[model samples]
Target: MKKVLLLTCVLCLAASLAGAADTIKIGVMAPLTGAWASEGQEMKQIVDLLGEELNAKGGLLGQQVEIISEDDGGDPKTAALAAQRLSTQEVIASIGTYGSAITEASQNIYDEAGILQVATGSTAVRLSEKGLQYFFRTSPRDDDQGKVIARTIMEKGVKKVAVLHDNSTYSKGLADEAKAILEEQGIEIVFYDALTPGENDYTAILTKLKAAAPEIVLATTYYPETGLLLRQKKEMGWDVQLVGGDANSNPDLIKIAGADAAAGYLMICPPVPKDLPSEEAQNFLAAFEKKYGGTPGSIWAVLAGDAFLVIAEAIKATESTDPEELADYLHTSLKDFPGLTGLLSFNEKGDRVGDVYRVYTVDDQGNFKLLQ
Candidate 1:
């Protein structure tokens, strides 16, 4: 009787191990706590919701899909560690580490492990330029956004501009690109500087910017710092047009800077899908609002959903989760994927192909209006 009982225990344990082996694991890396935690939380929520939907429809390749999420704290070193840990856990692919600097810092680890990484938010052009075989982004690159911003500024008859960044990989890359495009268009850059993120005050920087008297101020930083800078600019009574990168498009900017201060500030970003021409996009917007209890607080939510869809589609098409095969399908076959954000496709360099950017300005009510 004792021997028979022991055999039953062994069989149950073996079955448990086999079931675990049959589950498809995907890694989710994001800043669950830190300056970017709000955005990261939204991304995580979208991924979790999508995972549930996929499982409800009979998961991928006859296996249950599981998302193993890790918090990177929006730090590069932490991102690398998270990537290393996820690689060891048999994740077929990983998504995120939102900031470009963190993603760049962690790419080598995923590359060495041959794990596909779909970047949901990182937009530094160098991310794709690094020839990383396993790295791809659902977001548009900074250069594309820069061009749109430059053209918008030129159209506004702004001849003198100031460029500022938070010295982050994403901010600096977009700032530099915009500066170059502005210069090429014969616009004088009166001031170009980098600010340390998380600083309590930027009065001194605003004083210097006042001296330059730029007609337009272009900031390529995340919301917290961008809000601070804009508020300071207003308090200092520096009259200038303000514009920023995609990161600055979040509603939190108005919340931080106050509706009055954020009013009339423009941002170059991917078009929000709420009223887009795509019927699928409209459905996604409605479903997301219904499930999440609000409109998405940031674009990261949309990109996160798109990243999940892209990965699931590849898995379904290839009928395998092997990283190499998945990467091959993404590069060669994933075209015109009707993502919530847009029609998605990857170029040879792993950047989204033919992305469209729009210029938006904050209205007095803290709502975004597409620039006519």
Candidate 2:
């Protein structure tokens, strides 16, 4: 009886191993429960939907694709733990994460473990500057976005502008970029400061900002803070126009600030699905709506979709999951690869090459209207 039991146990273990080998495991790290939960949730949903579609088309490299997800809680310490867990899971690659600081926490872990990472929304310019062979991002760099924001502000003829950030890595980077450009162009920076994030009342900040009396308030912060700023700015009866950076492009901003408060707010970000001219984007939008009952809430989620597509393309083209080979292909070989967002390509530093930011305004109806 003991021998028979041993035989059965061995067979069961072998079957489990076989089942695992039949699928390719990919890791997704996002803030599943945190201030950025909406962004993280959308990122997971988009990647999962993409994986399902890939499997329906016969999977990748003759193996079904499995997404191993971990919640980073939108905190650096939490992201490190998530990355460590993913490194041991036999995942060939990882996709995600939204905030720049959160992504930075996991970047070294993946690189040292020989896992290729494609960041979806972390846009800090220094991320690609580190020369990590396995690091790449679908999001444009902060410097590029800064130029766009500065130019848009200039076009609006705002001589004096107030720059605000939440002191997060991503927010501060963007604020600095726009600030430099605005200064060089002789635009007066009336006020420049960072706000403590996750605060309920920005009334004190707004009170200080109102004193500055700038023509426009350029907020380089995330949706949550931006939403509060907008709502509070209205309550304080400050009519100064507010312009936001890419991080403020989520639908939750409108929900947080309310349509009346958010209306006419300008932002610079990548074009959303409806504005994407490619048939590929249109088709993806249709498929996403069909499956999820509506389109994604932000362009950041669509950027995640692009990240997944590029990884899949690299795997299919090279026919290998080796990190070095995949990175080499992405850096040297891939060019104008049609992505859900646009033609995606990477420079030697692994930054997506192309100007991706566009100026958009929030309408009274809570819709993002493309200005350019």
Candidate 3:
């Protein structure tokens, strides 16, 4: 009798484990431990919150959602390995590996495996131009952002402009687009060059820019380099309007550049939607602040949230976790997902369908304020 009871318990345990294994796993590949670690961590948090919310609402397709997060270290090789690992784990869909270079490097692995990839922040237009059916982006491409930035600069009455980029795929792409647009608008691009991102000093580049006497200096760089450039430019007394791409919209820029130097620094990025266009946006902001203990550190957080929401909704609508089926649903059925950032929908190329970029500037209080 004792042996029969023990056998029964063992069988029940195996069944429980099998049930647990039937969860819907969503993989997150991001820079969780390198230069872009902060943003990666933010992405992880957003995914976690999404999983929690989905589980609370009786889960997706009657199965609990599980997030499998991997650190890509913001490097191409690392991103490729991460992608392979996630694909091997059989995650239904994956998000991130933020920078465009890393995203490009890892995309082939995901594409070959038929895994769906939803990019949260990689904005290089080439990603969409590749005609990959399995890939999609929740963020606007650099071409869209570049037009907005160039038009904003021209509208601000800035004629002579200098363009600088960090040479990363994201930064250089935006710089090139902006350069073309500015030139087409008859705006003189006095100085244009790319800088290595981690260089300690940019005084030499700043000196050249100072000599160029551009009324506006547009830098396409990440936060760390942007902070250093802004500080050095201020110390050099270069009296030009300093503007940058979405990467500079982080609070760390102000922390690194100091309040005085960071003030009036403009960035073109997806608006944070202070007015809360939808109840979902309002609830997300409140819940994010309550759970995370502060406002989102960057717009990447908002994009990450939207990416997860879109993927989750697609899974629920399709009622299947099959990667190919989910990708088809995402491409065809997912439309106008009222995301925290804005209305979210993908075009035929898997790029977000609408323009969401807005001009933001650091106020004297060292906070980002939308410029109407």
Off by over 4 Å in 2: none
Writing each residue's lDDT as its tens digit, candidate 2 over 1-372 gives 999999999999999999988888889998889999988988999999999999999989998899999999999999999999999999989998899999999999999999999999899999999989999999999999999999999998878999999888999999999999999999999999999999899999899999998999999989999999999999989888999999888889999999999999999999876788899888988999999899888888899899899999999999988889999999999999999999999999999999988999989998889989
Q: Which candidate should be chosen as best, given TM-score against the real structure?
A: 2
Report lDDT per candidate: 0.86, 0.92, 0.86
lDDT of 2: 0.92
User: Over the stretch 148-244, how does candidate 1's per-residue lDDT look in tens digits?
Assistant: 8888889889889988898888999999998998899899999999888999899998888879989889989898998888788888887587888
- The residue-by-residue lDDT of candidate 3 on 9-128, one tens digit each, is 999999987976779888999999887888899899988997898899888877888899999998999999999999888787889868899899888898998888999889998999
Alpha-carbon deviation at 6 in model 3, angstroms: 16
Of 1 and 2, the candidate ahead on TM-score is 2
Question: TM per model?
Answer: 0.95, 0.98, 0.93
| Candidate 1 residue-wise lDDT at 371 | 78
The C-alpha stretches of model 3 lying farther than 4 A from their native spots are 1-20, 273-276
Worst 10 residues of 2 by lDDT: 271-280
Q: List the residue pairs that clash in candidate 3.
A: none
Weakest 10 consecutive residues, lDDT, candidate 1? Answer: 272-281
* Top lDDT hit: 2
